[model samples]
Target: MNWYVVYTKPKWEKKVAEKLTQIGIECYCPLITQVKQWSDRKKKVEMPLFNSYVFIQIEDADRNSVFEVAGIVRYLFWLGKPAVVRDEEINVIKNSLKASNIADISVSQIQVGDKIKLETGAFSNQNAIVQEVSKTHYILVLESLGCVLKIKYK
Candidate 1:
């Protein structure tokens, strides 16, 4: 069985993973403990490391079985196919989390001329090429949309 990514409804990553596991589907949802604060007090809460995403191990034929659980929106697709996660990559995440001294982890570095996909906003899911990178903004060329976009840092 290969590992695949599942996109879930907002704030439902843990729930979907739990339900899938109850149904005998092997799943993983990496979580981190974060300190949350309110006017009165502060509390530690576990939050999904990757929002709206859960990883599952399943065969190609059994892909649809995950739909039996609610909150699972669909499989994340890349290059016109369901995105597959190698077992080693999963292990890296697991091991890094286990290491107490590690304070932060960055997924990747975006450089000029790199091809990237926008994850949110008006260009959501659209692919673009990095034209220029600045301290406050990025100039990207969206070939699919036939336009250049300048995203400024907030």
Candidate 2:
């Protein structure tokens, strides 16, 4: 058996994985917990790390069975065949996530000049241009208001 990546409907990775598992297919959907803040509270939500993709270990004979599951779109193909993932790589990802706390995970790839929104705080929903990037904060320019503010990494 080999691990194959399957594309799923938007926000359906976990549901598809569960359906595959119910049919005795071994599937893995890596999730990351992200804390989102609202005016009243902050909540931690688990989101799929790979977005709309799930991994399933199966032989070629079981391909149709995977497609039968709702929300599963198709298998990711490489070189005209289903792409195969090494077990070692999967184990590495699992172990790394398990060893980290929710606060330790950070995704910071926004570049200078990227248009972004202030999702929280006083400027919630306002758009800003990233004026500068530092190790732990962003200096953004609110062009409409002609003001610059530094936002700390969340």
Candidate 3:
């Protein structure tokens, strides 16, 4: 059996994993603990490592088992088709994440004050201060120009 990434409906990874397991399909949904502070009290909560997704090990021979699960949006798809996630990659992802003491914060994936150096262009060698970080680029304070410039980190 090979592992496959399953995209689930929003906030449904655990729901889907439970449903899948009920039908006898093995699945993995890594979770982390986080403290949720409310106006009145704080509570610790466990949340999925990857929101809206889980990894399941199944074979093309057992495709129907996956479909039997409710709330699985679909086996992750490519251009109009299901895609396969390799066993090794899945093992690496699962092991590496499980080994870390992860906190389940809904913080932006990108953070301010990230230490980065320009890799290319005229500012190649300069150490930059990340003024703002975005999904597509980092707004950096170009010390030489005394202005902010966005660099595509991807």
Candidate 4:
């Protein structure tokens, strides 16, 4: 069996993985626990490590069954063939992510004109570019729609 990457619909990684597993498909969707603060309280939540992507181990004959699952867009194809991920590489990703704390993984210094994916809030999963940076916030520009958003970090 070979490991393959499947592209899923927005925010559908978990669901697709679950459904695929129910039908006897071996799928892995790595998730990370995040502590989020709200106005009244704080909660810990699990979110997909790689948004819109799931890994599956299967034989070539089983490829068609995978695409039948809802929310699965298609297999990630590279160079006219389904992209195959090595087992060792997948193991490294899983092990590294499991050993690190959320804080250590989340903090990164982004610069102007750097593109980033919004992981939380109303702009979740949207891609934006850094326009300006302040002490506790970033002024981001959404290029596709020509709008600017001010996002504050806690």
On lDDT, the candidate that comes out on top is 1
Q: Is candidate 1 or candidate 4 better by lDDT?
A: 1
Tens digits of lDDT, candidate 2, 36-106 = 99999999999987778898999988688887899999888767888787775567457645753322322
Output the TM-score of candidate 1. 0.68
lDDT of 3 by residue, 22-101 (tens): 88888888786789999999999989866777888887788766766778777776556566655544553455345442
RMSD of each: 8.8, 12.2, 11.5, 9.1
Q: lDDT values of the candidates?
A: 0.78, 0.75, 0.65, 0.76
Indicate whether candidate 1 or candidate 4 has the larger TM-score: 1
Provide the lDDT at 96 for model 1: 45
Better of 1 and 3 by TM-score: 1
- Residue ranges of candidate 1 with Cα displaced over 4 Å: 103-154
Q: In order, how many clashes per candidate?
A: 0, 0, 0, 0
**Candidate 3: C-alpha lDDT:** 0.65
Q: Work out the TM-score per prediction.
A: 0.68, 0.64, 0.58, 0.63
Which tens-of-lDDT digit does each residue in 73-150 have in candidate 4? 988886788888767556645764555332222325887889998674445455678888876776777654334655
> Model 3 compared with the native: what TM-score?
0.58
